[model samples]
Target: MFNYHTLYAELLSSLHGSPLEKWLPLLPEQINQGLCEQRFGDLADWRQVLQQLPEVSANKIELKDKIQIDGDSSDNTRAQIKNLLQALIPWRKGPFFIHGTHIDTEWRSDWKWDRVLPHLAPLENRTILDVGCGSGYHCWRMLGEGASRIIGIDPSPRFVVQFYAVKHFIQGGYHGVPPVDVLPIGIEAVPQNLQAFDTTFSMGVFYHRRAPMDHLRELKATLRQGGQLVLETLLIEGGLGEVLVPEGRYAKMNNVWFLPTADTMISWMRKCGFKNPRLVDSATTTLQEQRQTEWMTYHSLEQFLDPADHRKTIEGHPAPLRGVFVAEV
Candidate 1:
């Protein structure tokens, strides 16, 4: 009912005659697996809500400023759109504008984008891959920055649906843009040493892996020789050879496994065969950047921090300090 075959066909057409053509055979199987392996019991219900969304043509599509799909619609139509989106609650990584309604998400992903965009190589006409790209928010941003094509991968079925919801409106209104797709798969699902993308981004994902080195190596394999890698993850204040393995949870996130100092991260990147790894920016995540909103009515950064000392998490670990690093393959 989600029509993944159309998307898969589009992906194949986009990869034809490109260096990524090597992925042609394996992609279909992987996509089928991703669809068959969906664990979300509410997927059908979510798909129905998506189907209920009104077909309103966007008079203007603005991605450079914000993810806005603007057009004139009746108040009833706008309300319908808002209600449909509200059903898909806990929108984590966006502040998307549709018609006249604004769906403010949990994380101010634009802030993260601003911090990383300045330090990277030019994205104009480059093949790009975004690992752990939740809801394809940054993929839209990458497209706005003139990427030739963008492939985003995240295993979450809900996130994939959210991406396609946005994509549905964008593709219907805007035409002749480069290919942009989000696959429901993990980094491990990708073939090794594909060496296809001109630029690769792995943000907010490194610390979640138990074997950080293997994750780094996988990222390296996705890039072409000398391609740029944008690595952003949790960091602590320490010298080289220092990393934190949280006892239980860091900021209430159980999946977090490693929190490395900036120097240690650079060292690990070099060890993974990346070249000239350099720390570009390091900033502590703020409550304003990630907080509870109507669209995401869940516990957020404020609830995760220690009441006595805000600088530490509820578990007594240091608060979330994120670092952005750029390296070459």
Candidate 2:
């Protein structure tokens, strides 16, 4: 909806209008005088509040045409994403895997922030905490976009490398945001005081935790007044369905987690003291010759959704996810 650069342009234009009438019109009105002078300084702070309003201007955004398609196979798709990530930031090595299996652009481009970021309120001057921030894709992107500070916590040591790799490789990758510090421990280990943040985002990380509630409490502990949590993860379809139990791993994919329906997951978020938790987008993976979500890696489209293959066993238990859930605290 509202383009950052475009809005900035409007402010610049307004400032340069006819000096006599323009100055007269720009002066604060009677009731607004105190707010403009005491609360917002000049126009910058006022502009900041205007931008963060919970309004959707648009879902589409324009990015410099840097994407090059090598082909749509799994290997080629991964390469394209790696290059895209590199182009977004700088990385000497490739982008290591995060928690999701749907890494490909089935829904949105890796560089595509407009579709999701608009739904998330800004954190420019606020503290942001990301949980299970595998490789810190969300964390790093938020940093580059303009969060005041970012703290990423993941269990894997390799996350440290992936967390910083993109910024190391891409030109103008960090944008105007502050640097991020990634921790290699679980959320439980984060210092309690630093837990309070202006906003927090956890993606592809929460479902894997053994104790979802404890971690949710920890997540809530980090939020200050009027704060929000933007969470994204794989989910099931039916409302309040059976809680699937994982007997063993996929053997190949390491960061797998049990899939919960949107209803149950949202219920958990509500229990953790989050208000008005809602699903922003929900979709399931079906057939696609081209690589699908980050979840469909081990199998192809037909194989993943084949109804005959559904089972309690490891090999036939469908793909990593049947649906997706995006919510908030």
Each model's lDDT comes to 0.89, 0.48
Give the TM-score comparing model 1 with the true structure, all chains together: 0.97
Clashes of each: 0, 16
Q: Tens-digit lDDT track for model 1 on 1-329? A: 56666655777887889898888888887777765535668777777776777887778888886899877778998898888888888799998998777889999999999999999899999999999999999999999898989999998878887888888778757875348999889999988889999999999899989999999999999999979999999999999999999988889998999999999999999999999999999999999999999999889999999988989999999999999999998
TM-score per candidate: 0.97, 0.55
State which candidate has the highest lDDT.
Answer: 1
What digit string (tens of lDDT, one per residue) describes model 2 on residues 138-220?
A: 66567546676666666553334444333233312224322455554566655453435677776656666777777677777
